[model samples]
Target: MLQLAWGLCLTALLGWDSAVLAAKFRRPAAVFPLPLLCAAALLVYAGALPGFLRAGVWGGVGALGALAVWGALRLGRESVRQLTESSGLMLFLGGAALLWVVLFCLQPMFFQWDEFTAWGLAPKMVVQNGCLYPAQPGNLKASFTYPATSMVTVLFQPFARWSEWGCMAALDTLAMACLAAAAALPNKRRMAGIAVFAAGFVLPYFFADTPAGSYAAQYANAMADLPLFLLFGGSLCLYYALGGQGRAYWLTVLPLMLLTLTKDICFAYGLMAVFLIGLDLWWAGDAPARKRFLPAVAKALPLAVAVVAAFVSWGRYTAAVTPLQETAASVGSEGLSYGAVLLGGVRQLLGIGREEKFAVLMSLMFRAFFTRRVCLLGGGAAAVGCITLAAAAAGCGAETGAARRRVVTAYLGLAFCFAALYLFHLILYYYNFGESEALALKGYDRYLTPYYQAWMLVMLALLGQGAGSRRGAGALCAVSLAVLGIFAGRGVPAAGFWSDASSRYTLRQDVQTKAAALNPALQPDDRVLVISQGDDATRWYYYRYELTGTVADGFSGRYTEVGDTSQREKGDFMNLVSPDNEYLYAGDCTVCTPETLMAYMQETGCDYLLLDRSDGYLQQAFSPYFAGGLQDSMPATLYRFAGCDAAVPFTVAAQESGVAG
Candidate 1:
């Protein structure tokens, strides 16, 4: 209920025009609430709102609700009649809402490694500390370079207080809904729009290669990529709308700003998108089109540029704080020429079958789609592609030479830019690393997702424009529905049909339970150091709340010769276990000694030490100072410092507050 209210409030505050535009078409546009909700959270985090405003985001929610109501009332009788005319659109909206609610209830809290360390840790910290900075210096590996807009927000913060993962999942629902709304924008074909919307929900699962399916894990995790789909895709649609007659140009501002705020790569993406918009404007040729385009760009570019500048400044800040050697680990030192890089990428692409069969198979599926199929899936995709291309060709023939030149220039320019960017990303990966090794990496596939998504939106937009005939729209609607049905059938069983939380898939509940058990003994400001297998679980350690900070794995420690980097002359070392990050340990030396370890601990100011069973060898070495143990089904042990109290009561209420993730 609060989620719905917050969505409504957000819609009022930032997306009133978007809601009105959707109403103008009598379409089910539910996306207006999401970005506005995100914007509200971001404002509070940036300290733009009054201090008193932070107590509950709901106050802003109420005000926004009132504003939305007022806006609706002003729309008058004609608009009301227009909205009520679409009974079919209403049914689609109702069904989507019900399915999303069911999915939200069935999903578990985040258990993904990326979720814990990369993105989730920051929000968890903000919610606990009531501020954004890391409480412990050792906790910075969670990538301080990451943008905070979607990280710590009201949705996940005070409102969904009990479930950290649940907050992430709710945001996912909103983002998915927005993407659907973008696909269903302004055109009158209600069923086609809903099909487009359903495709957004199912496509990610179809693309996911895991046996457990995308929904069982990926979609629910609090990551920026999913939201990127909505913001970037919507920006393109609005860019297209600049050529049309509407007030959409005004609505494009916040989503574009949010896009820049959401991720580092967005800075480059936004710049390129702006460049494309300008190129398209020049080709639009019509003086009136140019007039509309210029003013929209004038209003949007300032905010977009400011966001890009702020993101770059934050990145520079993170770079300055990191050491030279550690910085090398993040990016490559040897630069490859463009020719060599491109050649390497092509060679690697052809040789994909040698490693990662999934990539090869998926590539073939996509290839089959373009060339024009094995079965319904590929055939439907090919048919859709053919229809869009044929329509584009016919439109090209219908235009005068000057108009045709303009259309061709814009399409070719966009195609070239996307290809260049995608190649640049792939080549960097292949050049820095070996062929098969790069293929094995996840970054290659991750980049492809956005690349395909952008193209998919473009194709869908083109198809919508050309399909003025009822027969064409009905064909698209049928193919889209078939695609949706196929994915829904496959995804449900793979996701465990909503029977279990999927918490056990990653074994994170025990981590939460252990943290809860240790919370009462420590103050809100007490710092705890977790000695585990690696830094992957650091965010998991910090998930719910019990400690001021957690010291996990990092890259800045003394370099040692371990693991196989036989290709390189000198291998990099594992970061030694140092609390303060002052001293370096090259595998052996003071680590095994009791006095040296205790002195290091004291220097680091860790109030408590939590040890994973994987670190049993280190636990044996520190057995002389063993204070006590934690209660758990898992192999986790806790020991207090020598001068600390011997006994502490275990509190399970916090752990029990929310039933598993």
Candidate 2:
């Protein structure tokens, strides 16, 4: 409940200025609050930017809090009423969605590997040190050089408490804001828009079989993907409004800046949005091809510069601090030519239609737009709808030749922009993964969620302008609501209610609690090295990462689990830091001798060893070091290095004599 209150207060505080400014520029009322929220997040980021120090963040939040209170008190009766009505159902849906996030957060089930290690760890270190730093050896479970957005997670850390709830609230707020933006389509057929967006966005959580997979799986985890997608969707809407209504599209710089600050992949998305916005501005009118283009270019230059500057800033920081892989290393040794990769990518895109499994992907995307599955049997239906809608509008015989041409150009331009962005994304993916290997296309559909939403918005605008009658609008709205009701009736629960024991909720809160209780037994400086057999050490990482509250290290059966790309040097370094089961620490003996194991312990400076008793390989390899006793719920054994100094000198002397081999 406190989290909900804080979320509302923070939203109002941050949004008031941006909303009022957007209103002055005649931006849509629904989108007004969205920009304000982003503005608020950016403001908070600015505060954290002075070396990302904690004191700076407090000062910024304090000032923003006072401003928010002042704004609330000064809202005139008419202004208050207008704000209330403008928010309407979108606010309710957003609130409801947040409730689900809160429920998951309470369970605090952080199942995604990247979340606990990469996204969650970055902000945590910032909170602990009061500033951002490079990923150190002891804490290299995640990508060290990803980018700036992970630090934004720090905003959710309540009073710098390092609570999971705080991080959950921050991410949920972003996700909800995005949904609200999507729901804020033109108020004409507004109910239909709300129904469609609410159902499509919310239903995925309840139904496990969704084509993009379970929506609940995402919201329930700590990944930044959902928020990033939503932010990208909001940016697309802003660009759509810019092209269609000619509002000050330059305000899009806010979303672009936020996007650059969030995820590495989104840097590319930010660039794509800027390019499309520039294109829209350049061709916005009925004037001769080049007359008004210069003015548009002048308006777009600042936004482009902002994105470029952000990219450069992020690049410089990572280059200085993070040991990220170079492009050549990322490409691997398979040596598939760029031309071959490009050709393979083209074939894959073209093959989506003929493939039966892609039928699900097409169906899901179409439903995202039209809501009704009746018209979404395959991609062919979408192709037909675009063609039919175009032909019907062309035959309306209602406008001058220039006007008709303009309409065609606008519809074609929107489609082309979406296609270009998606194709470019595919090309990049192919470049990263190579020809045959890229065919798997893992997580590709989820990544394209924003593009799907953009396509829907464009279709709506096309139908709104060209269908030429309220009847056509009414029919689409009705069909959309019907589809939405069918899904929402089953998926969304009563307000503030959630199924805590669903299949999506896999982690045990009880187990986590028990593990964390053990932390008090160890000293702050005492290092506990953890090892698990057969490569699955995900739960162990979460246990240590959350409970320890310090930079910690571990060994796993696989290097890939510890953020190793296809690089030998990194793998060797990891082996040196924490030897895996594969390493020969024991000579002739199946299990490691006390002397050899003691030397490893001394090298790592780990005073205690945490081993998974369930893992046979770990038990067989390290039984000599076992000091005894298992912990419940965690099902792991604790082994202490008793008088570790005795074996260390023996092992060192043996190494000096070349007998360590």
Residue-level lDDT tens digits of model 2 in 317-367? 555555555322233255565566556556666884244433444444435
Which residue pairs clash in candidate 1?
A: 108-661, 109-661, 560-573
Clashes of each: 3, 2
lDDT of 1 by residue, 1-661 (tens): 5544443333224345335435564433443443445445555534522233244355445545565666578764543453444332343344435534554566456555556554665555554444433323444442433544334344444553534544554455445435543454343655555555565555555444444433445455666666665566656554553442345444445555656666656766666666665565555555666565766466546646755764564455445555544322233346554465566567666674334543553454345334422222343254345334533542443224434444454456656676667556655654565556554543544554554455455444444433345655654455465556766665444553244566454556556665665555556545555554443433334442334345422233232232322321221112124333335444331122334434444555656555544344344444445533232233554555553222332111222233122
User: Candidate 2 local accuracy as lDDT?
Assistant: 0.50
lDDT of 1: 0.48
Error of 1 at 196 (Å): 2.2
Cα shift from native, residue 387, model 2 (Å): 12
